[model samples]
Target: MSNRSYSSQPKSVVIVGAGIIGATLGYHISRRAGMTVTLLERDLPGAGASGHSFAWVNGFGKDPRAYHTLNRRSLDMWYRLAHQLDADIGIHYGGEMRWENDPRRATQLRQRVRQIQTWGYPCRLITRAEMLALEPHLHPGDVLAASLSEADIHVETDTFIDVCLRRACEAGAVVYSQTAVTGFVVRDGSIAAVKTVDAEFPCDVVVLASGVQTTELASLAQVQIPQQQSPGIVMKTTPCVEVLHNVAVIHAPAIDEKHQHLHLRQLSDGSLRIGQGTQEGINRDDSQQQADALLDRARAYLPTIGDARAIPTPVGYRPMPLDGFPVLGFTEAVPNLYVALMHSGVTLAPLVGEMATLEIVDDVRVDWFASYRPERFSVRSSG
Candidate 1:
């Protein structure tokens, strides 16, 4: 709306993707004074990994550092937005039960509790009996000990942004769907316009958040960003008549199926979500068969999950930066261009959006994001 087209708002913004992170960033930053937001999406909102996701607002699983800090901040912001937007992200923050195998693992979980508490997040240690009481279907043999952090939420990314994006549009942002940004028009070192198959949208600033496709857009801006894809899949069951109320994750190493880490969670609609396994490669193919094997194996970890009404397999590619940690903020080489890419997106989306919004619109330092600059690898190479 203002003539200052050099930021997320105030300046016209052409966001390349409309996933959760991009939409949230657009939604939050568009509400600022003196700004216009123009969101460009290759597909419908939440269609990408944002839509096909585990949607766990997991503050407990992140490593204990800036990753944890960023995730925790995002969790706080999500709860705030749950109230502010009054939209459904299927936010259930009751708590997650992390199952343990033995005293040693239980001790390790105690350490996790100690670590989070040391950072000022409270968590409760529960016994096997307590866990069974919470998630009755959990195999008593599979779970030895557990940790329950009542701070986080379980979410469904599919419909999470319907309201936020709608609110963003209502508040003056223009979202172009099914219209991909073929490329960008760069003048000098700043972005001049965003080109698509339809029309050229001239803008002062551009945010590249096209998920796994970010590398392509980065190339358009003349930045050789190295982003890799990691595949992890989750299976969902049709709504259960008595789906357990809380999230349940087993910690024991021993399992009935081939050895791997496994997790179990009950969706608000009474469906069960199960995830386990990490596959790293450039796989464009959906590993439905491979995931089915894992899900079959996962049923043994939690027997009740196999009593499915219907099993829907979902595949996800975690965008692991060659340098672990997300890539965010403006490039040291290009002006008016910002990026947001992450492997653990839902955990980092809210913070990345809020912080990146803080960086792009307000010209703030974004010191918290020092760990995630894409240029750092290039700088390190030259150094």
Candidate 2:
């Protein structure tokens, strides 16, 4: 959209959604010379999917070598981004620890560790003693196989998002909270301006990073980006003594046949966020009973988690593409309209922010996003 032939370098860029992706992208674009950046959000930052995410930053579960590599690259880039920000970005750097109680799962875990290792992932199988050494308080019962992915970490999404938005604002970007996107002003085939509830932002380019609502917003421009329903819940707990001392995240084995594995991480405030099944697991129950059950399960391994009560959080709907990969880049029907929607927003924020800035401000198409182009979804006829 900022091509040399198409008017001088997209002087104005309007970004919809102030979530992690939008905040990161806004921060990056605002720093670019001669670009006026504006971020529009219907609610406060991190109030959407980013707020309720497990916030684990890892590539261990990403399948296919290319996808795994994408996550791995971003996971490493976080360190550099934090250094560049030069502020406390709520990044916990203890890596991830997990163990298997069943022989079948142990074999699967062993195979998975080897598979990722071949791709240069910093992960390996560990002995029971090594597991205990990494986490002394963990009472992992009957560990058949254990692992320590030394590169994995989790984030406090709220803290990181707040910091990013503050930095973006400091760099001359205007963030409009409580401003909902009404529609788009299209000229020829490109978005000329983004319309909000009470105002309209004239821009050369518009980006939709509105999480689960991306599909609906993009449709106003006649761009069809389909997404699957991916509602998940991550229950929070009252602040208590720090349970995770060495690791930022821990995946505990399921206690019985009906239950799934549990993953949890402690926030900087000493509150613990626990989730069941998998990162992509579907859970709609935000009832107090469900929260209590999850907290009780967490207590099974970390018995020292004394008096930390569970707090029910609403289910978060992930912006999952039908194929389960990110959908990035501009659309065929709307060249100046960029869509940044994905499930692993926290894991991919750094990479997407930097590379998308290149694609947007510098007008260069990135090869890394070739597989995730928006044209992959058939665009509906504008007529």
Best by lDDT: 2
The Cα error of candidate 1 at residue 349, in Å, is 2.2
Candidate 1 residue 360 C-alpha distance from true site, Å: 1.7
Clashing pairs in 1: 5-11, 9-35, 10-34, 10-35, 99-251
Candidate of highest TM-score: 2
Q: Which TM-score value belongs to model 2?
A: 0.97
Q: Which stretches of candidate 1 lie over 4 Å from their true place?
A: 1-9, 102-104, 248-257, 278-306, 309-314, 379-383
* 113-209: candidate 1 lDDT, tens digit per residue: 8888788675778887787677776565655557777776667676667777888888899998899889877777677889999799887778888
lDDT score, residue 239, model 2? 94
lDDT of each: 0.71, 0.91
List where candidate 2 sits over 4 angstroms from the true fold.
1-5, 379-383
